[model samples]
Target: MRVGRALPLAAAGVVALALALTGCTGTGSHADAPSPTQTAWTEAPTDSPAPTPGATAFVSSGTAAQNQPVFDAAIRKVLAKNAEADGNAVVAALKAAGFPMNATQVSQSTTSANLKPGSIMVGVKVGDSCLVGQWGAAVDGYQSTVAPVLGSGGCLIGGIPVVG
Candidate 1:
């Protein structure tokens, strides 16, 4: 019968497929094989210079005008570490500078075209005011500002929150 004939052919095809798959197992490294070539520390280095004692302390209970300098200094210091840092890095720098995460906002690093943007905004809400700044990419070393919080109660018009 045609069904009976097809069964053996199908079984042979399965066996052939199994044998073919066995070749992929050989892709694993063997102890006898040479190790990968030495890799230089190519990526951005994580280790940063020690912060100067009492450097640019954040004014926790101060108004946005009182804290804008601290916020600006914090971003500049981090950018000194990595000039091409993303929006998250800028936010992290502000966080490390004692800005609360929930009060922060950072814009997307890349545009909708999947290309690096001219600059990305970073902000930290201090009381009723917001500390907002733009940096990176085509930016020529930016200056941050202190402004009233937007109608959305955020410094940025459209951006992800720092806590997010």
Candidate 2:
């Protein structure tokens, strides 16, 4: 009789320990669980449109694509007002307009010629697609393509031009 009682108590203790270790006691919601590896690219809100096909390979979305034009126009307006704006200013303007900071990359010109009135490129990653805008002394335009999340260079169609 004593052994039987001890066995049931020991079994109960083990079950309790298992439950405690597994966090199954209703202490937290499923959202509290650890998530898999996520890059900055995966952080967009759930409702946005899926990344368009071939956006990473430097292929144009063609003339009918509206987002690129709108983004380009916005950036152009800012640059028109202040040609000396740098990468940080462009990025700040973009973020204020609700662009996700995690999914955006901004590169500024390093040489004196590319400085104020130089060049700045801003790339926003959507899924595997990228929307890039460039403005400065040497370039002014936008391109929609497939690009790395942390994009570099001018994203110019023919590569960054030699700017003096």
User: Which 10-residue window in model 2 sums to the lowest lDDT?
Assistant: 56-65
What Cα-based lDDT does every candidate model obtain? 0.78, 0.55
lDDT of 1 by residue, 2-98 (tens): 9999999999999999999998779766988887885642332234232344457666666666677778788888788987788888777787778
lDDT of 1: 0.78
- Candidate 2 has a TM-score of 0.43
For candidate 1, the per-residue lDDT at 34 reads 86
Candidate 2 residue pairs in backbone clash: 55-145, 55-146, 56-145, 56-146, 56-147, 114-118
Q: lDDT by residue for model 2 over 1-164, one digit each (tens)?
A: 89999999999999999988877557667687888786744544445443354232211232213245445555666777777677676666666555556656666456556435455677765444566776665655333344443344323333332211
> Lowest-lDDT window of 10 residues in candidate 1?
41-50
RMSD of each: 16.9, 16.4
In candidate 2, how many Å is residue 11 off? 92
